[model samples]
Target: MGQHLTIVDHPLVKHKLTLMRKVDTSTASFRQLLREISLLLAYEVTRDLELTSVTIQTPLQPMEAPILEGKKLALVSILRAGNGLLDGILELIPAARVGFVGMYRDPETLQPVEYYSKLPNLLEERMTIVVDPMLATGNSSVAAIDLVKKKGAKNIIFLCLLAAPEGVARMKEAHPDVPIVTAALDECLNDHGYIVPGLGDAGDRIFGTK
Candidate 1:
């Protein structure tokens, strides 16, 4: 973990991200594309998962097979937008434990305010992945990770659809042990804290809200 960031640059991820960035893309289409892209990014996030061999019965004979090591993963979605990534990743890793952290940005200060948090027990023993669609200002992400850490989560990974340089730097400064995975790292954050050239207001787009 050490302030790492992985940009998933696969063709499929790039293509879908392009469509998702379009303002003309329908809400339904945006949601679907997010699901699709999440599936692909899931590959990168879980790429380094440890595997151990165990004795197993094959079609013809007994053999050793590789299986995931250690306890099941814990996936903590950072509220509404994170759900889009969580759903798709869960489909890939059905045995994962699920949690949710709800936080809202303070209008005046542009800070994070935690509203709800319910996480699984034994967080320290599991690999936790925190999902949020946009890492624009990173205030929410940093706050959300802080809450997760307080629950004893040790191995943590932050997953998102898009990110800004400011957000990435902020995350590095706050939590260097948590790695970040995203489809694209955008240029910078705007005055309103939106990622430039990003799929605007991921929560609004995903939920069809203003």
Candidate 2:
């Protein structure tokens, strides 16, 4: 079975994504656009979060209200570019536990190697949402997911701002159970392995680095 990849077509998300895609958008504007898009993505990603009813006293009388059920969520960010998405999601899920998995590509092997990994306690009990701005080859995202799974995260969702078809297919093959949500699925990756017509190097654009 293929992994579920949802391209959030919400109006606001589409607008911000366009701004981010423009070559002329300034670094400040690019960073702000990313934050806005992430928040919109987070909203769609968490739409199905479990909620339970509770009885509480209101200003006038007692009434039943619904509150989040199950364990608090865990937001695992694939470092560097992923950190850009992490900030906005955190603003909405303020109580969510934060985790980081840092990986760097080996120039020789062209493989992802973990430099750091840390997650919250009781990961198995929490609904973990992993964020990475771009899913190109899917190697880094897959490795990050494996790390979290080893830490006992059964319920996982992969969130990205943009994705390539190859990357999405790779992830589905590796982990069919994980759902992938993204802003857009672009054309094939170019010869340099960057998503075609994709926002140039998300990390570089957002941070104003080379």
Candidate 3:
């Protein structure tokens, strides 16, 4: 919880990521790889979830069983592409509550503009994990996090597939307390705010849109 940033460097994660980066990777393959990689990333992010023991009965025996403690987790996706990561994480943590936040960039100012938001109630109590595939300029990410915080989400973690140095720095300055978990921390952002060496537009690659 205290770590500011975590770059998941597992071999499997790296392998799938390499495949995802290929321009020739078809939409179906890209989507499948995203789901596979997301499962691995979700494992790393949720590795430290608090657990408590509860008494349970097993065929002619009684014993204590470990179960997740405290309020159930809430998975909030930063719209469009975030849904790709959300679907895989949901497979791993099926019982988690889900929400969505939609935001688009302002072409003139290179800023984020929120268009939609729907969050769970009593967010202050539940641990919230926000998902997005690419953290480029981080304007939208920061805006999305701000919205969740306004709704009372105190404990929050951001999960993304790739991040630019600019985005990471921006997130650190804005929300130093929130931890960021990503697969790769790429080079600086390009002139148009795209992550250099990034797998192009995540939403486009994910949905086969240009």
TM-score of each: 0.98, 0.96, 0.98
lDDT of each: 0.93, 0.92, 0.93
| RMSD (CA, angstroms), candidate 3 | 0.9
Q: Give the distance in Å from residue 71's predicted Cα in candidate 1 to where it truly belongs.
A: 0.8
Per-residue alpha-carbon lDDT of candidate 3 for residues 93-161, written as tens digits (9 for 90 to 100): 999999999988887788998889999888999989999999999999999999999999998999999
The TM-score obtained by model 1 is 0.98
The reply for model 2, stretches above 4 Å from the true place, is 1-3
User: What does candidate 2's lDDT look like per residue over 1-210, in tens digits?
Assistant: 143899999989988999999999999999888998999999999988999999999999999999999999999999888999999999999999999999976756557899999899899999999999999888899999999999999999999999999899989999889999999999988766689889989989988999
lDDT, candidate 1, 35-97, per-residue tens = 999999888899888899999998899999999999999999999889999999998999999
Candidate 1 pairs with clashing backbones: none
Worst 10 residues of 2 by lDDT: 103-112
